[model samples]
Target: MKAEFVCTDCRKQFIAEGIKNEYTDPVYGPCVIYTAECPLCGGEGREYSPNQGGDDHEHGMGPSCPSGGCCPGCGGM
Candidate 1:
């Protein structure tokens, strides 16, 4: 089946399909898998399927602020 997941490194959205080997950590077993390049930074990585659709800074969530609000970590300038 096909699914939509966001890149943890880059907040860009993308679709993953044709995933044959969704298993990782043989002992732990296979889980959700991604088989596409990140749409934002073009990086290759994997994350839990549930982590999709979240704010990602490494992928450039925003330069300054999202909505005139302070950053979660740095607060504000």
Candidate 2:
């Protein structure tokens, strides 16, 4: 699924595409989550809705450094 988010740091908006994975959260029981990184900022974006359930919750990291794409999410690995 795809969603839009505004980077808190850069104040810019971007889209993120992610794959869904389901797992047992122990406390939450069955949980479905989508994880994706912002293309423009390479930030870790996360979103979820309790009412929707099994729905898309978008998330993003932060501004990216072009040198090595090093950020909290990618770690420049």
Candidate 3:
């Protein structure tokens, strides 16, 4: 599967594709296994699209993170 992530630090958007491991059991656990490297800044905490395995999409720099953080506007920055 393929997924897209946006770096919160450098404000870089990229895509990640690789194997996915899903572990789910009744008494064991529901652990998801996956690894990805940032294509741009090589940084982590790249927020994934809500549908895949990350947070929701925030458009335009005019709005900040829900917690009130840096806002990378629609390429305005």
TM-score of every candidate? 0.37, 0.42, 0.37
Q: Which stretches of candidate 1 lie over 4 Å from their true place?
A: 16-19, 22-26, 30-32, 45-77
lDDT of 3 by residue, 1-77 (tens): 67766665665667777346677978978977554567777766343654442333343223334444344543333
**Cα lDDT, model 2, residue 36:** 61
Best-fitting candidate, scored by lDDT: 3
Report the Cα lDDT for candidate 2. Answer: 0.53
Q: What tens digits encode model 1's per-residue C-alpha lDDT throughout 1-77?
A: 35565555765667764254555677787665555557678765343365344455334355535544455464432
lDDT of 2 by residue, 1-77 (tens): 88654444444556677657789998989998665665667765454333232212221222334444454554544
In model 1, the worst 10-residue window by lDDT is 51-60
Q: What are the lDDT figures for the candidates, one per model? A: 0.54, 0.53, 0.55
Report the C-alpha displacement of residue 69, candidate 3, in angstroms.
18
- Least accurate 10 contiguous residues by lDDT in model 3: 53-62
Q: Give the candidate number with the greatest TM-score.
A: 2
Q: Give RMSD (Å) of candidate 3 vs. truth.
A: 8.9
